[model samples]
Target: MSVRHDWYQSESKVVITVLLKNATEKNYAVKIGPKQIHMTADGYELTLSLLHPIVVERSSHKAFPSKVEITLAKETGERWQSLEQKPILVAPTIQTKNWDRLLNEEEKAEEKDAKGEEALNQLFKKIYSSSSPEVQKAMNKSFSESGGTVLSTNWSEVSKEKVTVKPPEGTEFREWEK
Candidate 1:
């Protein structure tokens, strides 16, 4: 299906807004890379190969009731002639990201702010949606049995035994009496 979107840019950042009617966090997934973006929601998919490289670690996105807004930090302040670059004929099997790039003061400060539980939940949903049936089963079984503390994608291991609760360090696991 077709995706409706609009984009605008400043010297250092580009913002893309994808219009998705009645879009919720459960129904959408957005993956951003240094030079590409992939968004899928409610049977619609939008992929963009950016005209210029971006600082992947500095990019951010937010979802509203009607749309998703993506903000990408440009590698340099130079203006981009267009949003999308020409499509490359061959797609690379592996793309490497340089996470060790020196962060500026602002980026370093932003890193201190935790993304919180909502982002973690969204990540798990994305993984569950994209995984195979066996993996999904394992995840569901393990998560349910372990009091939501464990999630495993390995069907062979999870199927062999019932997953026991293993709480975080310094925390004890307990079963409540009926």
Candidate 2:
């Protein structure tokens, strides 16, 4: 048994017309250089010289059907370049439903935190409002014993006894809590 492979070489020429944004139409004598060519969009005239040794001719014609004609020069001679096609790999798409569910859970968590903070503020206000002068003094004493400071609005007022707390050595402490 014998295996046989068939391949064909093909060449093509195309005439492209580019209209400038400034209302001027310029004809480019473009020779398809290599597998790709770069062109500017503005009205400025350009010469495709990157793939040099390949000659290109430019002319103005009134009777011609196309504005620009690009033809491979005879010096290039019927050289056939192989075209390779590679399979493109695409990433797996994420489901819209899963994304929406995750966003909804995050929004709910934020709402719960906001509600908890509001409740804490209300409880602090209630505790401060219901306490009287003697109760406030006792509470301030206890707070000082726990290594915290209590400030009073009245500058003329004085506390009879001062309380201080000293933590035992080798005890781990959080400075932020103070």
Candidate 3:
């Protein structure tokens, strides 16, 4: 569905009101994340990567006959001038020969999997060095169990030691460690 959003911000919260002209209250699904949003209205998809992250658990939405309003609690007490990373985002109406034809089931599944993995990796890498001893041990154990591969990792402040994972020269690793 072709849509536009009006964003409002306060010191502690941000609200987004999306106008979907031909949409109804019962025909849309919205997914909110820390720094992302995904919605499907009558099989039309709209996705956004937010400029600033918010408290995902505190976000909620309300649907009107022709619009949806989303409220997000900011992670900090700061006002924001913009909500999305892009300035001119036009919510494109998904193409469909029939109502359900525009649904991207496969792409949605792949994106969910990729986002989950990426978020986990980012969280681990961000706090690995500063984490408590128990957390560190847990992460290491988890990684070891999964055989996760990081080609090269440098803990610069932790003595500049680099851990490298290299397969034999002639080997071509093509599959994920499942």
Could you tell me the TM-score of candidate 3?
Answer: 0.44
lDDT sort, best first: 1, 3, 2
Give Cα distance to truth, residue 118, candidate 1, Å: 92
**Higher lDDT: candidate 1 or 3?**
1
For model 3, residues 1-178, the per-residue Cα lDDT tens digits are 5467888888888988888754564478889999998877875777878888999898998887777888989999866757778767687997657535446776788899999999987976888877776656555654453345432232232223333344457865455668
**lDDT of every predicted structure (CA atoms):** 0.89, 0.43, 0.72
Higher-TM-score candidate of 1 and 2 = 1
Q: After superposition, how far is residue 112 of candidate 2 from its true place, in Å?
A: 1.0
lDDT of 2 by residue, 1-178 (tens): 1111122322332223333332124332333554333333233443332222333442121213332323333224444443222335787996557878888999999999999989986875677578776656666665655465443322224245554454567764456655
For all predicted structures, in order, the TM-scores are 0.47, 0.29, 0.44
Which scores higher on lDDT, 2 or 3?
A: 3
* Per-residue lDDT of 30 in model 1: 84
Best by TM-score: 1
Supply every candidate's count of residue pairs whose N, Cα or C atoms clash at under 3 angstroms: 0, 0, 0
- At residue 106, what lDDT does model 3 achieve? 67
RMSD of each: 29.1, 18.2, 28.1
Rank the models by TM-score, top first.
1, 3, 2
